[model samples]
Target: MTTTDADAVRLVLEGDAEAFKILVDRYYDRCLRLATHLLGAGGDAEDAVQDALLRAYRHLGAYQERDKFSAWLFRIVVNQCRTLGARRRGVQALHERAWIEQGDGEPAEEHPADREATREELQRALSRLDADQREAVVLKFAEDMTYDEMAAVTGVGVSALKMRVQRACKRLRAMLTETNHV
Candidate 1:
């Protein structure tokens, strides 16, 4: 039986702490995907997700009923990503500069490895995007979220989120095409 997020929350508040597992089970994969895309599937990415989940668990009582549980949970995840991004700002800046200078990066050093190379190219291109554009793209395309949902998670205006997504799409396309992966 599919449990509603509100029902799960109510169960937890009613002293059934195990009920919170429903929410975590439902959202964990999605949260991990977003975190991996944003932080490139490394320890940092996993750490960001763990930190967000911990914060959500600790502050579950503070979650107001008005917002969708996902929006609130994702807000926590995004904020955690932002903090990680800031800490790794210099590394990302260097990577972005190198991406632009190299024009889609060096060759794969092996020709027949098509799918893995394509995925790697996409990951690199995604990492080169500014933090906001990366988050917007992950939310809008990868997560299939509506603009308002994205805005709720990000606390950005819908128009701004739209602009970020549009720009990200354009940049991603340009990078992929340059790499001959598109």
Candidate 2:
């Protein structure tokens, strides 16, 4: 019998702290995935996700039933990534690590060397994007989120998020093309 997120929340709030693990188990991988993409593959991504989870646990009382728990948690994860990213200011290396760590689910028939080169090229292209644009792109494509869902997690307007994604895609294409010529 799978307990719903709201049920788990209620259990936690009712002093059953162990019930909180249900929420963690449900969302940890997804939160870690987004954090790893935003911050990188190293301890930074792990740290961001850990901090976000702790924050969520601490502020569970603030969670409203009206909002989807996943969105609320993602908002915290994204913000935590932003805070860590700003502090480190290691965007280039971080982006590269993030891309490489995000393994492509390609078939074994693909040559490993070719796959690595493609990953590196993509990493370079993504690294060139500004923070906002990068975040928009990662959330929209990697996370497979709709604009409305993005707005809920990011606190950004839908139209602005759409523009960022559009601009980021265009810039990434241009950057990749330039690299290919070089």
Candidate 3:
């Protein structure tokens, strides 16, 4: 965590209620990106992140000083994403199909067609993962969080977080390979 984050968290805990905004501004986009990666686009990711922020605010007093603020915030976001993912599972198939179809019509940017295809393939593979594995992968890869930080956020042992990430990577590689994307 940065000194700024630590300072903001300390200020919030000390009852300078508005100091929480600094932490919010610092983390909000990263949290949204994590949620988007897990939830697979559209507005659900935004909703999940917002809900997580609210939950974190409400529970601020319970936060342990020993814990990294980022990890604690991530835990709240991941939980919110998991809940939203479960509720939306039934509609995901339709959403995925529509997303792919719509994507086909868009012009590719600087990235090559194959690159775009690979990215989409990875996204699909990620979406197929169980919630825990997906969360582990996103936190490790996208957030660049250490195993200890992930463990703190996930309430799992470091070994377990490593195992989850390993399994998630293996599954994603296999899925991508099967799709001829790798």
Best by TM-score: 2
Model 1 pairs in collision: none
lDDT of 1: 0.76
Model 1 misplaced stretches (Cα beyond 4 Å): 86-113
lDDT of 2 by residue, 94-178 (tens): 2222322212533224365676666677666676678898888889877888899899999999999999988886687677657
Who is ahead in TM-score, 2 or 3?
Answer: 2
Q: What tens-digit string does per-residue lDDT give for candidate 1 at 33-82? A: 77776676568777988999999988999999999999999999989988
- Per-residue lDDT of candidate 3, residues 32-80 (tens digit): 8877877866788889999999999889888887877888898898789
Error of 1 at 150 (Å): 0.6
- Which 10 consecutive residues of model 3 have the lowest summed lDDT? 90-99
User: Quick one: ranking by lDDT, best first?
Assistant: 2, 1, 3
> Could you tell me how far off, in angstroms, the CA of residue 131 lies in candidate 3 after the best superposition?
1.6
| lDDT by candidate, in order shown | 0.76, 0.79, 0.73
lDDT of 1 at 4: 93
Residue pairs that clash (backbone atoms under 3 angstroms), model 2: none
Q: Point to the candidate with the largest lDDT.
A: 2
lDDT of 3 at 20: 88
